[model samples]
Target: MIYSIFTALSWGKDLTHLFKRIEESKIALAIFSGKYAQSKWCLNELAKMKTLAEKNKLKVIPIFYKVKVDDVRHQKGEFGHNFWKLARTSSGEEIKQWKEALEFVSYKMGLTLCENRYST
Candidate 1:
């Protein structure tokens, strides 16, 4: 269902439209994988999801795939390494928003899939 909404957009499409769709969604499922923080778009979506959750009671379900919740929350381990690398080139406000979003989602109860579980 979520992918259905995204199917209309092509690769490298404008994110503004995606953000609008996110605002309209009743539920948002964020899959925080190893490279999640590396993508600014993902972080922006997470930030919007957090705002929606706070103001509109939008349900946010985070699925940690091959990543630890602690790593995401504290920005440690591989996720931290990459995030900090990104922070070096990003604006302060942008990093702040990403950090807040990661912290907010990490605290919520979510499912974590072990690295081996999804590997062939």
Candidate 2:
């Protein structure tokens, strides 16, 4: 089964409900793109996934979609630019958490889809 924020109808459900679903799921796929780090909601979901992986042994598969793994791991290039832009309006603690989550996922072994894959 696939769970996507855009497709999921979560009118009254809180993030805890989403996290709980993540925790219960057998596998979680995190598709990291250029603007992924710019959204607080995305960062929070990733952070929760990381925590669940460590504590509950939930498996997380990171997929780099047209983005460099190094850029995500180190927060450099486009990912860095977008993240910093979001950081401007975020608290230090929030930024720290997002950074930590990015760092954690970056180190994991994942598939990377380069620009050529999507090019015509």
Candidate 3:
């Protein structure tokens, strides 16, 4: 079963709680929006999910929402711009983990929903 942990739905949860949910779940839906790369928490969560998935403890599914897979994988376009901003203040190890996580998640089976698909 695919158990999704939407960040929007987890507004009040603590870090330990969030990590616990990810650890206990079978699948996690990581939605990569235009500004996703800008948030430190989101990137860390993705990194943690990547770590677990690598150990065969969890499965991560990426959702490219109004973003491109290649952009996310290679940190290109707006996503890259935001990531670079975060990278400047982040340690090399953090950037490495985040980048590896993004690259790993980008290659997994997932869905892409462009802006044209929905109106805001």
Candidate 4:
């Protein structure tokens, strides 16, 4: 099934509305995209979506744009291209938030959501 970006990123605006639409629709994946998603507020909102999906037993595929692959790194200072510099520049708070977000999404949703398909 096809889902519009408008509905995907409607967590804060109208998450229940969006979920109702998703439940009625046949879409296996939904893509959430927007510039506002880069903010901390959006991150918390996504955690909410994961909760909604779990409670409803729905599978959601989140699609993000403008987040370059080279922007993220693993704890071993690996993954991203500029690993050394990125690790050095990233503050403890930033890293903690990133890890916490990752853990929350993974534990709550039972899915990575990120495009880590190559890991398999």
Candidate 5:
């Protein structure tokens, strides 16, 4: 069976639904794109995944798609800019959690899909 928050019918449900799904998942893939940090939901999910992975309850595999791992980790360049934009509108504690999550993913063994994958 396949399940993902990405496939959720509606987020109108309690946020716990998302947390439950994350807990139920054995493994999770966090895809980091240019605008990834711009979304609070995405950051929150990554935070959850990071927390579970820390406890050995879940395995997280990060995918850096056209975004540098350091950029996500340190919040640099465009990714950082967007993250700061989100931060300005978010709580300090939440931002700290998201930053930790990004840092965790950057050090993990995972896939980095850069541009020109189809090229020589």
Candidate 6:
């Protein structure tokens, strides 16, 4: 089974269409992870999706991305560089938000690093 964790923007843009495809695919499950999914507009849409999925007995998991400091700097190059720019220009509140987003991405990247390091 192929699981998908599409972003919030992607969901907003084509959720109905994508969900339809997913239903047709008859996959085991579909997972989505994003912060925007928490917004009021998105939440309502999510509810509709949930209802539809439940009606068809489809499995859909939504994961919220949380951030951490220790892992944020792991990808210290292009991607990190862009984040750095945002970090520099962001207001205190925005920085706080970005930090959270970065943490999630960084932690996943860290896991990738660990796997590669231990691979023989």
Ranking by lDDT: 3, 5, 1, 2, 4, 6
How does model 2 score by TM-score? 0.83
Q: Which ten residues in a row are the worst by lDDT in model 5?
A: 1-10
TM-score each candidate.
Answer: 0.87, 0.83, 0.88, 0.34, 0.88, 0.30
- Model 4: clashing residue pairs? none
- Worst 10-residue lDDT window for candidate 3 reads 1-10
Model 5 earns a TM-score of 0.88
Q: What is the clash tally of candidate 5?
A: 0
- For model 3, the local distance difference test gives 0.87
For each candidate, the alpha-carbon lDDT, in order, equals 0.80, 0.78, 0.87, 0.41, 0.83, 0.39
Q: Pick out the ten consecutive residues of candidate 2 with the lowest summed lDDT.
A: 1-10
The residue-by-residue lDDT of candidate 1 on 22-115, one tens digit each, is: 7667777888887888888788778888888889657787888988899999999999988898889899999999899999988777788884
Model 1 weakest 10-residue run by lDDT = 1-10
> What tens digits encode model 4's per-residue C-alpha lDDT throughout 20-104?
6555543333222333324444444444445546576545553433332223213222323333334366667654554444344
Best-performing candidate as measured by lDDT: 3
Candidate 2, clashing residue pairs?
none
Candidate 1: where are CA atoms >4 Å away? 1-11, 116-120
Total clashing pairs for each candidate: 0, 0, 0, 0, 0, 1
Q: Please provide, for model 3 over 1-120, each residue's C-alpha lDDT reduced to its tens digit, 9 standing for 90 to 100.
A: 444644555667776777777788889889888899898889989999999999999988889998889999999999999999999999999999999999999999898897578322
Off by over 4 Å in 4: 1-16, 23-34, 38-45, 69-120
| Residue range 1-120, candidate 2, lDDT tens digits | 334542165435778777766666666778889998787778888888788777756677789998888899888889889989999999999888888888887887778888677311
